[model samples]
Each structure stands twice: as structure tokens, then as C-alpha cells.
Target: MRHTDLFYLLALQKVEGVGEINAKKLLSHFGTAEAIFAEKSHKLKKIDRIGSLTVERLKDKSVFEKAEAELRFIEKAHIRAIAFTDKDYPEKLRHCPDSPIVLFSNGNIDLTNRRIISIVGTREITAYGRDFCKDLIATLAPLDPVIVSGFAYGVDITAHLAAIENNLQTVAILAHGLNQIYPKMHKKYMSQVMENGGFMTEFWSSSNPIREQFLQRNRIVAGISEATIVIESAEKGGSLVTASMANDYNRDVFAVPGRISDKYSQGCNNLIKTQKANMLTSAADLVYMLNWDLQQPIKPVQKQLFITLEPDEQKVYDFLNSHGKELLDIIALECSVPVFRLSGILLNMELKGVIRPLPGKLFEVI
Candidate 1:
């Protein structure tokens, strides 16, 4: 932000009764935030939502001075501040109905990364949620897509950390200002994220991360991404709100399934049964849903190699890796087992995401 526009922009944000929507209206009418600050009470009040009282408050010098101090804090924190008119402002977020006028971003991560996806779920994640994170990360790790989440516990933090661990850039859209990390316990992870990615908020510096702000924050998570993945959620919660917003924006909604009896899983199953989200069983499912290619040709598995396993037929995996590929006769000789029994075990492993089946009745580790 330019020096002259800095404090005035803060004043516009801090002005009493100048809500986000009306603030946008004033900006649209005046053509620049600079012009809006120069408006007289009567001119500012001309905007549809700008009430007479709001116009009266806009003339206060103290409001602008206090706002100037806020800007000083922003500068001290090494934060990036952008108005609606800034060229680098996220276009997806800017088009939202209640888009924020001034956004504060901390750290050096780019908000403009292409193909961003938001993954969110309950604060109380289950073992299933944990497993989902591991598998999903392993699958998409090679794609390098921008992963986004609210950075709350459970599914939110799982998704963000997975992306970071896999060397993928990720962003957390915070409900709080750039001044502090909410829930403070995750400060260590937040620090890692800034080193690898960064933080974002529609709210300004020093604003408390109240509950309502999260509802608004969730919209950006949905709006800014190519798709929103609901790892887990309840019937009524912010995750549902994000899924709804993703639908409204015509972005793909992908969800992971959980055990039906599990409360956390109930939301995911409901989303699937209702057709509100596409059910994904693996990372390949996600790639297919997104219509993207697998990163590269994973080496192929080839023949009836399972029959040659030594006794303890289930230990075919150890045999395959240690013994190299084998034919049916070679396998039957090694394991001294019927070819039929060995075939079944190999098929089961293929179904388990552990190995891939090959042509001419062969199998290999994936």
C-alpha cells in the first residue's frame, strides 16, 4: 500500500457503522479509496447502505488517527496489506458478495497459486480422519497443488500439515487478524507455515478472532479454491457452510467417507448419500474427479508370481520383493501351494491399494 493511502484505508475500515458491503459501495462510487476518503458526509451517504449516522462518523479525525496507529502495527509486523483495488488481490475473493475491502496477509506465501483446494472438517477428528490425511497426502504430494484450510484442529490442521510435509505450498485463511495466531497452541505449526507458506485474513490487525468471523473466513476458503474437500463435518457447522459456498460457486466438492456409526463420519456419509459431494476412496479418485493426470508413469507390475511364495502364503509380498518376479510354475515350486490359493491372495493385496494388478495374470508393488 502507498504511504498516503495507508492510514486512510485503515480509517475506512475502522469507521463506525461502515460495514464491509457499504465500504465496497463507497469505493465503487468514488473509483478509489483515496477518493472515498475525500468525500463529504453528504456524498458518502449517497451510497445505498451508507446510513446518515455512518456519514457523520466518517468526519471524525480521531477515527482516522487511531486507524493510522493500526497501520503502524501492520508495518511493524511485516504484513502485506491490500485494498480491493490492488492488482494482486485474489480475484475469486474479490467477486464474493461480501468481499472485504482491506485484507492483511502475514509472511511471504503467494495467495495467487493456481489450483488451490480447501480441505476442512470437524475439530474432533477421528483415526479415520488421520488415515485419510495420510493417504490423501501421499497421493497428491506429487501434484504440488496449493492446499488451503482454516488451520483449526482435526481435519483442518491435518490437511495443511500434510501439504507442508509433502513439500506442497499451503495457506491458512485465519479468522483472526495477522497480529496473532488463534488457539495459540498451533503457534509452532503456524511458524512452519509462514516459513513454507503464509497466513491470511479479511479482518485487520488487532481484531479478535470471534466466532462469526470464521463463517466469513470459510467463504474465502471455498471461493479461493478450485475445489473444497470436506474430510469431516457435522450436519450444522462451518464445514457445511463451506461445502454450500463451493456448490454456489460451481466448484467441485469432494469428501472422504468415514464409518457410518462414527459421528464425525456421519457428515461425510450424509454428504455422499445426498449427492452433495462425490465420494472419494483414494487419491486416484481425486485425480480422476479433478480430471488431472497421474504425475508420471509408476513402474508397472507384471505375471502369476504369487504361487512361488514360500510357506505362509500370505507373506507373498515379502517373497515378491525378495525373489523378484516369478511365473506360476516357479511360485508353485517355491511355496509348494496350489496356484488357485496364491491367486486369491494377490488379488486381495491389489484391492488394498498396496499393489497393482498387471496383464496376463501378473502383479507388482505400486
Candidate 2:
């Protein structure tokens, strides 16, 4: 975006009662912020929902001074001001009605034709959650999906590290400005994160990581990705908020199921039970749900040749092997197993690579 246009856009944000929705409305009607300011008061007031009070605020010349200062700061800091109309702006987020008018980003961030997924969870991550996160990332590494997170502790940091370790681009959506890192301790990982992906935020350079800012940041985390995964959360937490936002955005959401009594698992279990999220047990679940195709050839599963299978798994495998290719129901009936139980058996067999699951629950021996 041109500096002069950005200056006016920044000034538009300073106007009281002008938020993302209203700002967008004003921009859409007037074409540019400059035009909005240049228009007569009566014409401006003619816009739907643009009250006389807001028009009066728009006439406040002090906003230009603040916009100039912010522009100078952005130039000095070398931040990229991604306008909502920019071609480089995240496509998924651009469709959101409440997306920020401008996003401040830094480092080697790229979203061109990338598969993006957000991982969010409780700050107090448990051992199970950590292992699941790492294993999930490692498994998904083959498909090379971009990971998005809040860059906070526990599940957020864990997801970032896993993505970094797998050489996947990981974007950290900040609650504060690019001028500072929150929690202070995460400063150590800044270099690695920037090298792999980068940081992004809608806040200005002067904003701080306050409570409301973090809550506001959740929307970006949810909207930026095609899907959001809740690794673990309490019955109530920010991760749940992100999950809810993802659902509201009409994006797919997946939750890792944990023991019913486990504290962190309560949120995920509730999401699944309430049909707010799908039960996510492995990377294959995400891959299948998102319909992501592997770019590289899948390495032949040699382990299946020597791998052992339990009785139920062996029974299902044998039935599928004899039947050549069969639907899940047929395999279940032939094996004398219920459909619910057979689903788990087939999933295990698929993971073991002894059997391959086809579309419509059809399975055949590999």
C-alpha cells in the first residue's frame, strides 16, 4: 500500500466508533480513506450506519498526526503493512467480515498456496498433549502444512517447536505489537521462528499484550487457517474461544480426545460431544478431513511386513484380504464385530499399512 494511503487508513482507525466492520464499510463506499476525508459532511453522513457523531469524529484533524507518527514507526521498524485489499493478505482471513483492516508482519512469512492449520490449546499442557502435538506434526510433515499459533506457552510453543523441527513454516500471531515479544522468555526462540516462518499481528507498534488484546488475537488465529486443532484445554479457556471462533467462521475444527477425568481433556471432550469439533486422534485424521494430497510419493510401508496385529485387527485384515475390496459394514458383519468397534479396527489396520482404506469406507489389503 502507498504510504499516503496507509497514513489515511491508520487515521481512519483512530476515529471513535470506527472499527473493522465500519471501517470496511466506509472504505467500500468511499473507495479510499482519502476520499472519505475529502467528501463533504452531508455526503459522508449519507452512508448507511455513518452517524453524524462519527462524521464529526472523522473531521478531527488530530488523527492525521497520529497516523503520520505510526507511519514513521512502521517505516523505521521495516514492518509490512498488509492491507485488507492486498493480494498477499491471507485469503481465508480476507473473507472474514471482522478481519483487521491492516496486518503488521515481519520475517520470511509466506502463505502462497499453502495449507494452513492453527493449533491452540491450554497453557498448562500435559505430557499426553505434548507427545500428541509432536507426533501429529511429525506425521503431517510429509504433506508440509503451515502451522499457525499464538506463540504463547504450552501447546502454542509446543506446536511452534514441532513445526520448526519438521522444517514447516510456522506463523506466530501476536497479541501485542511487533516491537516486543510477550512473556519475555520466548525471546530465545524468536530467531528460529522468524527463520522458519514469521510473526503477524493486527495491533499497532505501541500496543501491549493485555488480556483483551489476547482475546482479540484469538480471532486472527482462528480465521487465518483452514482448520483449527485443539490439542488440550480446560472446560473453559482461550483455546476453546479459538475453537468457537473457528466454528463460527465455518472452518473445520478437530479436538484430541483424552480421558474423561483428565482436566485438560475436558474442553476437547466437550467440543467433540457437543459436535463442535471432530475427534482427532492422528495426523491421518486431519489429512483425510482436509483432503490434502501428499505432494511427495509416500514411502512404502515396509514395517507392515513384519508388524504384529491384535486379534481384532487380524480378523478385520483377514476379512478385507479375502474379500479383496469391501465396504466397512461388510467387513464388520463378516468379522462379527459392531460397526463402532470395526471402525477402530480398520483405522488401526490402515495405520499399520496392512490394509488401505478407500473412499466410502471401502478397504482392501495393501
Candidate 3:
């Protein structure tokens, strides 16, 4: 966007009563923020939800000064200010109802045709959570997914670091502005993260990392990804808030199950018990559930000369070989194998080059 256009948009954001929804309404009606500011108050009041008070606030000249200052900060910091309408904006997040009108970012971040997933959980991460989180990233590394997180301690940092180690792009969505880093201790990782993926935020340069900001930050972590995975959490925490936001966005949510007695497992277990999230036992479960395998180029289906199959795999392969192509449920039913067990068996068969998975959960023998 042009500097004048961004200046007006930033000013519009500073309008007291013009929130994301209302701002969208105004932008849609007026065509541009500059046009909205140019229009008379009476004309603006004609739009739905544009109350007289909000229209009056549009006249506040002080907002323009703040917007000017923010623009200076953005220029100096070399941040990319992305509007919701931009093609480069997160595609998944653009569909969200309460997505930010503008996003500020810095780094080698790219979301085009990428498989993005958010990993969020307890700030006080445990050993089990750490191991599961690391292994999950390692297993999914082959697919080159973009890992999104809040960039906090524990699970958030764990996910980011794992993605870096795996050489996958990782995004850190912040609770505050780009001018400063939070937790102070995490400053050391800034350069590494920027090189790997980058930082993103909706907050202005003056905003600070505070309580409400974290809650607001949760939505970005959830909305920006194809799925949100909870590595571990207590009965209540910000990670759970992120999971809830992901659910509200109608995106997939996954939770790593742990022993019931573990304190951090309570939230994930509750999410599963309530049918809010899928039980994420391994990376295969995620791949199978999300149909991510279908997006990749399938290997040529030439049967390996001496590949061995487990009995269950043989049953699945025999069914597919005879049936041509069959739905996962049908194979499970005919072979008397549970769907959960059948998925792994089919994956192993695919790896052995004896079978291939089709779209819509269909399977065929090589």
C-alpha cells in the first residue's frame, strides 16, 4: 500500500470505536480509509453499525499524529505492513471473522502454498511434552511445514526451536510490538528466528506485552495456521485459549495425550474427552487426519520386490488390490480392523511401495 493509504488506515485503527469488524464495514462501504476520512460524518452514519459516536471519533486529528509516529517506526524497523486484502496475507487467517485489519512482520516469512500448524501449550512445559513436541516436528519435517507459535517459553519456544533445527520455516506471533522483545530472556533467539522464519504482530510500536494482549495474541496463533496442536497444558491456560480460538475458526485442533495424573495433561485430556480436539498420538495421525499426504507428489506405485507387510497391512492391501480403490471405512469394515489401526497399516503399506493413498481417504494397491 502507498504511504498515504497506510497512514489513513492506521489513523482509522486509532479511531476509538472502530474495531476490526467495524473497520471492515467502513472500509467496505467507503472503498478506502482515505475516502472514509474524507467523507462527511452524516454520510458515514448511513452505513450499518456506524454509530454517531464512532463517526464523531473519526474527526479526532490526534489519531493521525500517532499513526504518523507508527509509520516512522515501521519504516525504521523495516517491517512489512500487510493489509488483510493483500495477496500475501495469511490465506487461512483472511477467512477469520476477527482477523487483524493489518499485520506487521519482519523476516524471510512466506505463507504461499505452505502447510502451517501452530504448537501452543503450557509455559511450564514438562519432559514428556518436550519430547513429543520435538519428535512431532521431526516426523513432520519431511513435509516442510511452517511452524507458528506465540514465541513464549516452554512449548512455544520448543516448537520454534525444533522447527529451526529441522530447517523448516517457523513464525513467532508476538503479544507486543516489533520495537521490543518480551521475556527479555528470549532476545537471544531473535536473530536465529528471523533468519529461519520471522516475527509477526498486529500491535503498534507503543503497545506492550500485557495480560489482555496475550489473550488477543492467542487468536493470531490459532487463526494463522491450518491446525493448532497443544503439546501440553494445565486445566486452564493461554494455550487452551488458542485451541478454543482454532476450534472457533473451524480449523483442525490436535492434542498430544499424556498420562492422566500429569498436571499439564489435564487440559489436553479434557479437550479430547469433550471432542474438541483429535487425539494426536503421532505425526501419522495428523497426516492422515489433515489429508496432507494428498497434497504431496505421490511416489510411483511400483511394488517393492521383497517388501514385507504386517498381517494387518496385508489385509488392507489385499482389500485395496481386489477392490481397485476403496474408502478407508470400507476397508476397515471388510477387514475387521479399527479405523485408527487401519490408518497406520495403510501408511506402512504406502511406505513399502505396495499401495498408494488417493484423495478422500481412498487407497489402492500398487
Candidate 1 local accuracy as lDDT?
Answer: 0.74
- Estimate, for each residue in 24-89, the C-alpha lDDT of model 1 and write its tens digit: 888778876668867787877767878778877777778777887887888788888888778888
- Model 2 segments more than 4 A misplaced: 294-355, 358-363
TM-score of 2: 0.85
What are the TM-scores, per candidate, against the unseen true structure?
Answer: 0.77, 0.85, 0.86
- The lDDT values for all models are 0.74, 0.89, 0.89
| Model 2 agreement with the true structure over 170-278: per-residue lDDT tens digits | 9999999999998799999999999999999999888999999999999999999999999999999999999999999999999999999999999999999999999
lDDT of 3 by residue, 116-145 (tens): 999999999998889888878877777789
Which should have the higher TM-score, number 1 or number 2?
2
